[model samples]
Structures are given as structure tokens and as C-alpha cells.
Target: MKIHLSYGKDGLDVEIPERNLAGVLSFGASTPLAHPEEAIARSLQEPIGSLPLGELATKAKSACIVVCDITRPVPNKQLLPPMLRTLEESGIARNKITILVATGLHRPSTAAELDLILGQSMVSKYRVVDHHASVPGEQSLLGETKRKTPVYIDKRYLEAELKITVGFIEPHLMAGFSGGRKMVAIGCAGEETIKTLHSPRVLDDERCREGSIDENPLHDELMEISRMAGHDFVLDVSLDANRNITGVYAGHPQEAHAVGVEAVRRSVRATLKEPADIVVTTSAGFPLDLTYYQSIKGMTAALPVLKKGGMLILAAECSEGLGSERFTAMATRFGTATEFDEWIHQHPVDIDQWQLQECLKAVRQGEVVVVASGIRPEHRDKLFVRTAASVEEAVAQGLQKFGSQTTIAVIPKGPYTLVEVSRTSA
Candidate 1:
């Protein structure tokens, strides 16, 4: 059986023996938008739970548009032009409008990357800046939320009379879903603010799981932070497996994001008959799998459908290496997953520790084998996981360890699709 898994830009294909293969899991394909530009324009013209974007922009002297950084697969090129036109038609000058890249704690986008994210023409005409979380002076404190989370956002974003956020809606590891309040709460927030929200105590909550929102403390805290930051109009888009825009939610941040989440739920949710002994998955391909830190999402997504003591083979490009020094340090400091959990129990204030902890949670579920061309073999050891030269080699080792009859599953799209094993199977 030949199966193609989402790898770098082109994708990677592997041939598995028919007798060894169990099933290939993925999200149900959704209908792509026939006219993305027209849909975006229409959404802006008739926004939900609020007045149209043009009407809202009328009284504002200056506007700030926040967008996701390079790590996300948001169709900014398709969404931004029409949004800018709407603001322009409402009397807001292009010079007065600033496009802020909500980078969170991630690195700033490069010139070429920014051109791809916002288009070369838009970059030259409008002011496009990256949010700097490490710089203290660039952020302003907006007081604390009810959960006592300190809210510090970019001062320039706060200075704008009107704030608008654009993002792609998808299942997130920590926040249940990504979009709406998250663009500001995490994207434009200062380092301290991000640290507070990503703290171990907050992430340890049961409701913080994927696809959950109502009682999710992380989502609730972000909502509170967004409310304190003041009213923000949002434009959230949902894409199909092919990365084409399938749904667009515009207007009030919270309400519109809810609409997008429902659309995403319908597209991503899948049920598996049983857990697999060996699962092979990818980190959702290029851009997303650019670094090891981001690649962890694919492992977490595959964990639910993997049986205990099973083998998990992850194919990630990780072209940027470990991505975070703090994360790498955390992994190296603790020898095993248990030791890492012990350290977190004793001290939970460290930044980026939650990500390492989350990675460890998936690691504890099964043995992990990585096939990363970008990560060095020596560095792979520090991650406390075995390394393989290719996906075929990893699967061959799994078969040898678990025997040929072991059920095997493949998640080609990885984190892009959620797998839920049936209760009867458990």
C-alpha cells in the first residue's frame, strides 16, 4: 500500500505492505471556497454580532490590524487586501493603518517571509511591523484578569483607535482553539503576559484539552484579557485540508471565533475504531514543521490514537533546529519524563517549560522515533528519543519490535486532523 504523508513542500510517500497496514486516518475533506475574495468582502460588508467593518472604521482616526506570524497557515494574501480596501473605503488612510504581525514569543519574520505573509505590494504601501515581546518598553500593562493573569500588550496596538485581528481557526494544544481572543492575548502580548498564561498551573487544567472552549481556563483568561484590551473586530477564516479557505467568520471577536470553531469542528474531528500499535504521522508539512518546538504538535495529535507501549514515528523537517533555547534546556536538564514532571511540580514559573512538559506527556504514552533531516543525531539524543534516517526505517524498526501483526495507522495530515478512538475499543 502506498501512502503519501504531508512532509516538506512536496510531501513524502512510503509503501507499506498491505498485510501490515490497518488504516490511514485523516479529516473529512470540506468544500473549498469558490471565490475567497468575494467571501471575504461579503463578510466585511455584513459582519456578525456587530456593525460592518466600514461602519466601525468611520469614527476611528487610526487602526491597527493584527495578523498571525509565519508559523501559521493563514491565507493573509487573500484576506488582507480586501480588509484593507474596506478600511480605506471607510475614510481610513493607508498611512494611518499599521499591520502588526502577532509573533507571540516567536522570532520576527524575515523580509522575504513578511513579503510572503502580507504580499510585497502591501508591505511597500502600508506600515508592516513585527510584535516584539522581548522588548519591555514596547508593551503596556493592561492590568490583570479575574484569573490574575497580567495583561501586557503592544503599546502601538493599544494606541490605535480601532483594533482589528485576522487569523486562521484551528484546533490548538493549549487554548482549545486558535483565533479571536488568542491573536491579542498571546500574539500581541508581552513576554511576561505570555509566560503567565502558559504557566504549568494554567495548562494543567482538564478543560485546557483540544476542541474544548466553554470551561477552558486558558480560553477564559484570554477572553478576559481581550475584553480589558478593549473592543476588537475580528476576521477568522477556516481552511480545508488543501489549505483553501472554506469558511470565514467576521465581526465581534468572541462570537465570530465561535462560528469559526464550529466550522473547524466539522472538518477536523474523526473517530478511530481502535488504537494502533504503530502510528506514523507528520508535523503538517512545511512552515509548520520548520522547527522542533512546533513539531511537537504532531506528536500530541497522534497520542490519543496510539496504544500504550506502542511506537510513534514522527516525520518533521525541523529545519530551524530546536527553535527555543529554553525548551532545549528543559529537555536536557531532566533525564526522563518523570524527572521533568517532578521538576515542574517543584518549580512551575519557567518560561517555555509548559511546552516541554506537553511534549513529555506524549512521550510517556509511547516510544517516539523521529525522522528529521534537519536535526543532528547528537541533538536528537538530548531529546531522549531514538532517531531514524527515514520514515521507512522507522516503520521497519516498529514492525520488528512489535511483530508484523501489530496494527498500524497513518495520519498523513498529522495535527491538521484529530483522531478519537471509540470507547468500545478502549
Candidate 2:
């Protein structure tokens, strides 16, 4: 059987022997909007749980719109035009409207990346800036949440008379879902705020995993932070497998986000009858798999359907190699996942450790092998997991470990597809 996995820009095609194949796991079919641009316009006009965007803009002097960084495949070009036009037509000047990229703790988007994130025309026409979480002066203290997580948000966003966030709803590794308040709470947060939220105190809880919102402590904390920062409105969308707009949700932050989450939940979920002895997956391609740190999401997302001691194979482009200096240093420091996990528990939370912490979850579950061509030769041996030359070689190695008859499952879209086992293995 031949399977095309989401990898880089063009994707990857690999042939697997038919005898060992369990199934090709993928999202349930979802229809993309026939007229997405028109749908977006209508959504802003008849937004849920709040006044129309134009009316909200009419009452404000200055406005700020937050957008996700390059890591996420958010359709900023489509989401921004209607919003910017609405704010400008309602009296806010071009200069008064700022477009902030919610970069979180990641490196600032480069000039070329900014053009890719927001169109080049949009980048030049508006005051487009990346959030610098490390710069203290750029953030304002908004006190703390009920959980005592400190709230430090971008001053530009907090000071704006009208604040709006645009993102797409997807199953996040932590914080349950990725849209709504996350675009502000985490994206525009200061270094201290970002570190505190990602600390083990919040992420250690199992409820913080994907597809869990109501009981997710991280989600609750983010909502509290957004409210404290005065999150005014949100325009979030649900995307089909093709990355086409499937649903457009606008208006009140909480209400609109909740509606979008349900729509996404109904569409992207995939279930398996039993655990697989061997599983192959990807990091959902392009910008998502650009670095090894980001590729960890694909591993954790596949765990629910993987048997204990199963062989997990990942194919990520990792065009930028590992990740941030902090993440790269910490990731290669420990020889084993247990060593890393123990050290993180004893010391204070450092930048980017949470992702490694999540990565260790999959490591503990089973052996992991990666197929990445972009990594430097010297750095490849330093990885905690094993490395492979190609997807075929990785699968061949897995077959050697578990034998040729092992049941194999494949997740083509990786983290984007919410994979779960329906029943306990006998």
C-alpha cells in the first residue's frame, strides 16, 4: 500500500507492505466553505454574543488585532482583510490599527517570514510588528489569575480600545484547543507569563491534553488571563483537511471560540478499534514540521492509539533543524527521557522545557525513531531518539523490532487528526 504523509510543502509518499498494514488513519470528511470571503464578511456583521465588529470599532479610538506566528497555518490573508477594512471604515485610521504577531517565546518572525504570514502588501501597508516577550517594557502587568498565574500582556494590545484575535481552532498538544484566548494569553504574553503558563504545575495534569477543554487547567488559566487583559472580541475559523475555511466564528471571545471548537471536534476526530504495535505519523507538514521541537506534537498526538512498548516512527522535514537555542541545548543535554524529566522537576522551569517534557511522555510509552534530512550531521547523533535515513528504512527497522506480522497504523496528517482508540486492548 502507498501512503502520502503530510511533509514539507509537497508531502511524502511511501510504500508499505500490505500484509502488515492495519489502516490509514485520517480525519472524517469535512466540506470547505464555497464562499469563504463572503462568509467572513457576514460573520463580522452578525457576530455571536457581541455587537457587529463595525459597531465595536465605531466605539473605539485605537484597535489592535493579534495573529498567530508562522508556526501555525492560520489563513491570515483571508481573515485580516475583512477585519482591517471594518475597523478602518468605522473611523479608526490606518495608523491606529496595529497588527501584532503573537509570537509567544519563539524567535521573532524574520522579514521573509512576516511576508509569508501576512501578505507582503499587508505587511507594508500596516504597522505590523512581532511580539517580543523578552522585552519587559513592551508588556504590562495585569495582576494574576485565580490560579495565581501572573498576567503580563503586550501593552499595545491591552491599551487598545478594541482588541481582537484571529486564529483557527485545532487540537492543541496542551491547552486543549488552540484558538480563542490563546492568541492573546500565550501569543502576546511576556517571557515570565509564557514560562509560568508552560511550567509543569499546569501541564503535568493529564486533563491538559488534546480534545479536553472543560476540565483543562491550562485552558482555564488562559481564559482568565485573556479576560484580565481585556480580550474584547475574537474571529476564529475551523479549517478542513485541505486547510480551507470550513466554519467562520466571530464576536464574543468565549462564546465564539466554544462554537468553533465544537465544529472542529465534529470534523477532525478519528478513532481506532485497538492499539497498534507500530505507528507511523507526521507533524502536519510545512511550518509546523519546520523544527524538531515543533515536531514533538506529532508524537504525543499519536500516543492514545499506540500500544505500550510499540514502535513509533515520525517523518518531519525540520527544515530549520532542532529549535531555539534553549530548547536545543536542553533537548540534547540528557541522554534519556527519564533523566530529562527528573531534572526538570528539581530545577526551576526554563524556557522551552515543557515541549521536551511532553516529548518524554511519548518516549516513556515506547521507542521512537525520527526521519529528518535537514538536521546537521554533527547534531543528529545527539538526539535522545533514534534517527532514520528514510520512512521506508524507519518502517523496516520497526518491522525488525516487532516482527513482520505486527499490526501497523499510519496517521497521515499527524497532530491535525485527533486519533484515539475506542476500547481497551484485551
Q: Which candidate number has the best lDDT?
A: 2
- Model 1 lDDT per residue over 214-305, tens place: 88999999898898887569999998888999999999998898988988988998877889889999899988899888888888888888
Model 2 scores a C-alpha lDDT of 0.91
lDDT by candidate, in order shown: 0.87, 0.91
Q: Total clashes, candidate 2?
A: 0
TM-score attained by model 1: 0.96
- Candidate 1's C-alpha lDDT? 0.87
How far residue 43's Cα lies from its native spot in candidate 1, in Å, is 0.2
